[model samples]
Target: MKKLVILGAGTAGTMMLNKLYKVLDREEWELTIVDQYKTHYYQPGFLFIPFGIYKKDDVIKPKSNFFPPGTNVIFSPIDRIVAKENKVLLEGGKVLNYDYLIVATGTETRPSETEGLKDKLWYKDIFDFYTIEGALELHKRFKDWEGGDLVMCIPELPYKCPVAPLEFVFLADDYFTKKGIRDKVNIKYVTLMSGAFTKPVASKMLGELLAEKNIEVIPDFYLSSVDNDEKKIVSYDEREIPFDILTIVPVNMGSDMIERSGLGDDMNYIPTNKHTLQSDAFENIFVIGDAANIPTSKAGSVAHFAAEILTENLLSAIEGRPLDAKFDGHANCYIETGQGKGALIDFNYETEPLPGTFPLPGIGPFGLLKNTKINHYGKVMFRWIYWHILLKGRELPIEADMSMAGKYRV
Candidate 1:
């Protein structure tokens, strides 16, 4: 039997495993999934953890529990991928050969890439909401924080959940207001980007929201070093931003194995065919989700949409057919604006986020580019959908391609 090996049991890999497992002829193929960890984290929930919306118990589960019956799972760290030999070497010298390989090894934060980011100030006055540990630490620290000049910054772009840092500051604004110390606390936002987000229209809307909340913005400030002793972030242009507590999204990178294998771009993301999900270097290998250097938001929505296309293309490849499925970089997300209200944005490679309804023309229970309580409910209900439907590889009602039916090109 031919072998199919998938690396990383995260959202994309897990979903792909289930989707492909049900389609591939079991009589003719064998499948194996490898990951370094046993637990699967609902990463989106990491955003709400610092605000105490979700507890630790709510966001993590065993990776094996999501797999289908008759699937092979190996829990071990990988050493490197020997692409020349089409083999993967495990940390302990174990090797696995594959007729097909899928790399879904997602992006992760590397705070050490920044000077003094992981020093003594880490988890004390400095924290991140991207990881479970960082969020939990910030939660504990915020309990006693009097909050003076709380500065949050993004060191670089291409970070996972691009809008998350903005979400954090917004939630912090509401969080402090409810605590009755809103006047005593000064909330400030710092970013390397010129605005609140990457998209122009969305950024303007979000930037206005920041203004409405009375939060100051430090735009276009590139970080050079963190002076933890003085609690300030220094920029290459010699600009210094002082803070009482600093929250930062550090530089994100792909799996180190990709770098070691000599199969990645400078940032270690796989060079993938943007529309087809095929690897640029190898015919039999595919890259999906945050691991692929696609010009799209590295959010879970992008992965879910791409999976629908990738599965079809993979099946075609296995049958010696041309890959016809196209991934249009479709990504949609619920942006929580605090006060039990949220906004939704839908767009793809060819289109930016437009002011419109979603999925149905003028018939959305959910609103777009507009904040409402119903959208917030959709955001909360998504956690349930993620565990039950998304991880199971069930087809969602939404289409893989971006729909312009409900959009107004304003």
Candidate 2:
């Protein structure tokens, strides 16, 4: 029997496993998934924890719960991948050879990458919402705290859920206002990007929203280090921004195993055919989610859409057909602008986010680029959809490829 091994078992890995299991012939293929952690985190929900919208229980579940019954699930750390030999070396010296490999070992926040980021102020005045611990700890710090300069900083790019920092400041505005301390809390959004977002239209809309919320945006500030002693963040050009409480989206990097295997770039992200989701180095090896250096938002929606395309391409490769299915770098993001209002954006490669209704023209329950309570509801309802429909590889109402039906270029 041939082996089909999937690494990581995170959102991308688990979804791929379920998608392939139904299609691959059981008699000819042996399915397996490997990961270091036993718990699966709904990473998108991590942003809500600091604001008390979601709790620990809501974002976590046993990894075993999602795997199919016959799957050979291995909860062990990966040492490295011997790509040339088509074998994976686990920590205990055990080896698993695969006929095909899916590298879904997602990206991670590296606080250590920045100087003084994990120093004395860490988990005290400085916290990241990327991790469960950081989010929960920030929640505790926010509970009884008198407000001051609430700094939400993005040190670098390619972070998971790019809109999260914006959401953080937006929710902070609502959170403090409800606590009767909106005036006391001076919220600031600091980022490496020139505007509020990568896309021009969305950035204008979000930047205007920030201004209306009385939050300041400091753009193009490349973070050098955190001055824990003086309680300030210093930029590379010697600009310093003082903070009372620093909530940061730390530098994100792909798994070290990618580096160990010599299959990744400088940041450890696997160089992939963005249109095909196949590793540029190895034809039998595919990459998905944050692991691949795909020029799109490292959001769950991107993974979901890419998974559909990947499933088709992998099957074609198995049957010796041309891998013709293409992933258009499709990404759909829901931005929570706080106070029961949110905005949605959908686009793919060669297209920027546009203003219009989503899924249907002039008849969407959720509006694109327009803030509405229904958009907020769409986000709220997505958590359920993620667990039930998305992770389970069930077909969603939206198509894998992006459509130009409702969107209008401005």
Candidate 3:
């Protein structure tokens, strides 16, 4: 029997396991998935946790609840990937050899990378929304506190759910308004980018929204270090921004195992073919999720799209055939603009987001590049789809490739 080992039983790995379990011959193939975590987090829900929209129990589940039978689930941390020998070294020095390998190891926030950021102020005056602990702590801090300079900052880029930081400020604006403290709280946004977002058009739109909300922005501010003692953040350009309460999105980096294996770039992301999702280092080793250094938004929707094409490519590689499917970096996300409204965007590697209808060109219930209440409902309902349909490898209404049928040029 041929051995197939998938590392990190996150979104990508779990979906691939369900997809392949039904197709691959049980007698000819044995599959195993390894991860140190027993709880699976609904990472997208982290943005809502601080707002009290999602509780701790709402965003997590046991890993065993999702995995289908016929696959071995090992709960252990990985030490390194031996790509040359096609084996994996676990923390306890146990080795597992495989004929084929899939790397779905995802990224994590590293606040320690920034000097003084993780100092005394962390979780007290300073908080982050990327992890459950941070989100829960911020929730308590927001409940009984008086208003001051509420600063939301992103230290660097290439973070998961790139729209989340924007969503955080939006919700904060509305939350304070409802509490009758909107005038007392001065909201400020500090980002490393030159605009509100990565894309030029979207940045302009979001930037204008920030202005209308009376939110101050300090663009092109590269974070150098945090002065926790003074409650100020210093930038590389030597500018200082004082904050009473700081909510930050820390520097995100790929798995340490990728770095240990010598298969990743400076940021620890694996060098992968943008279209094929196959590792450039080894033909048998494939990558998905935030682990691959792909030029696209590191979001969950991208993982679902990549898994569809990757399953086909995996079959092609195993059978010694040329890969037929090519991923187009198709990614769509719901931007929670607060007050029972949200905005949606759909685009690929070539096209930028523009106004249009989605799913059905002319008859979309969900508008593109436009804020709508239904879009907010879609965001609320996606939790059900993620648990029932997505992890089961069931097909969604959307396709893997981008469609220009209803979209106009941005």
Q: What TM value does model 2 have?
A: 0.99
Native-to-model Cα distance after best TM-score fit, residue 175 in candidate 2, in Å: 0.5
Give the per-residue lDDT digits (tens) of candidate 1, residues 1-410. Answer: 89999999999999999999999998888999999999999999998888788999999999988999999899999888887788999999999999999999999889999998999999999998889999999999888887688998988879999878888888999999999898887888899898888889988888899999988888999999999989999998999999999999989999898899898998889999999999998988999899999999999999999999999999999999999999999999999889999889999999998888876888898888888898899999999999999989999999999998899977
Tell me the tens digit of each residue's lDDT in model 2 across 255-317.
Answer: 999999999999999999998898998999999999999899899999999999999999999
Q: Which clashing pairs does model 3 show?
A: none
Name the runs in model 1 displaced over 4 angstroms. none
Q: Order of candidates by lDDT, top first?
A: 2, 1, 3
1-410 in candidate 3: lDDT tens per residue?
Answer: 89999998889888989888988998999999999999999999988988889999999999899888879889999999989999999999999999999999999899999999899989998999999999999999999878999999988878999899999999999988988999999999999989888888778878888898888888999999999888999999899999999999999999999999999999999999989999998999999999999999899899999999999999999999998899999999989998999888888899887778887888888888788999999899999999889988889988999888677665
Q: Show pairs that collide, candidate 2.
A: none
lDDT of each: 0.92, 0.94, 0.91
Models ranked on TM-score: 2, 1, 3
Residue 61, candidate 2: Cα error in Å is 0.8
